[model samples]
Target: MATSPQTRKAIADSENALRDTLWTDAADRLWAHKTSGGFVTTPKTMPYVCRILDEMSKDHPLASTYEALWSYTWANNAFLRFNKPDDVTFAAGFSGQRGRRTLLERMRRLQLLGFIETQPNGNETFGFIFLPNPHAVLFRHQAGQGTPLPDPAPKGLSTHILPASWNAFVARALDLGCKDVKLLLNPPPPAPVSAAAPAVPAALTSPKVLRRRPKAAAKA
Candidate 1:
């Protein structure tokens, strides 16, 4: 059932009151965009992306590769680009050959899963990394080109993700040079409505619900 306006307003007011009481200092926090090291822009529903990563590889572990990429990205640029002279060495965080090999393997896995695109330079395979919107990639994976989903495909992947989130993902993908127009905009169909589901009240769903003023308040 949809939330009543009074209940929603009460919850919001309570949360605001709590914030006003608890978070008294801004300096104590390490701001993402303003911080010295900078931060990565991730999807709102990032857990879905993490679950998808887990399905791709069990040995490498989910989010490890994802976390590594975020660590390597030090810029606060909107493009979400990551580059360095010795990117392999920097990304691996080790000078040894073993570390390089492990990083390389992880990079390949990410590439295969459509998370990143590598621009090779001479001997250095992953010299440049282009991070794609993971949510967009998730949508593509679900489409599956008429083939059966891989054993690792997350359950309820499409249904669980929101349409607004999908729109953001598509926009990001396009900005980052995604050429496949059809696939990016092609979202999975909405979930089938259940016959037993309760009907939502028109007042709750209408846009002007919050704008309506009480007759006494209007008179004043």
Candidate 2:
């Protein structure tokens, strides 16, 4: 339910005026020719990575977990070389041992929601996977952007992530062209180890700070 930045700038100006009046036939032998191989290179901000994986798997049970990790990251070029034989039960179509235990419980819920990173292989526990930078892990799962989830933070697991669905996923990937992309929305906040530490106020540098839970911890 995104597409709003003025209808994604009028559908990127009607797909750049239909790619400036598309012309085709360079003696066309039926198009699909990336030097005669199947294509895989992906992110022109893939519709903001499929609406941030459908608003972060709306009430997840790994709801198709971004189409089974885009069919197990089809021959990935940018890092993420998975253990490919049988390609995790053929991308979890449910084969033997219930499709390798449902693709190892959807890659351990995409590595407990930070969207992947694994290595174990002797026992084949997701034999090598990495894939971070899901727009800097959805701006560090949004709740306060200081980045601290992954430690018993999965009981009712809703790591906020709303800021108008992260500014309509950077305004539909900068109206579909996706240059800079606000440098992946937000990341560079690490340096200050201790220049005599004491000044973090301006309302706690808010990317999120609305605390008022305690109605029995909001009836947890």
lDDT of 2: 0.60
- Tell me, by TM-score, which candidate is best: 1
Question: Residue 188 of candidate 2: its Cα lDDT?
Answer: 71
RMSD of each: 18.6, 19.2
> What is the C-alpha lDDT profile of model 2 across 100-217, one tens digit per residue?
6656765666676666777877867767776765666665665456345467664444556667767877776766655445655554788877668778887856755545454787
Error of 1 at 21 (Å): 1.0
Against the reference, the lDDT scores of all candidates come to: 0.58, 0.60
Question: Model 1: runs farther than 4 Å from truth?
Answer: 1-17, 26-32, 35-37, 74-97, 146-220
Error of 2 at 1 (Å): 6.3
Q: How far in Å is the alpha carbon of 126 misplaced in model 2?
A: 9.7
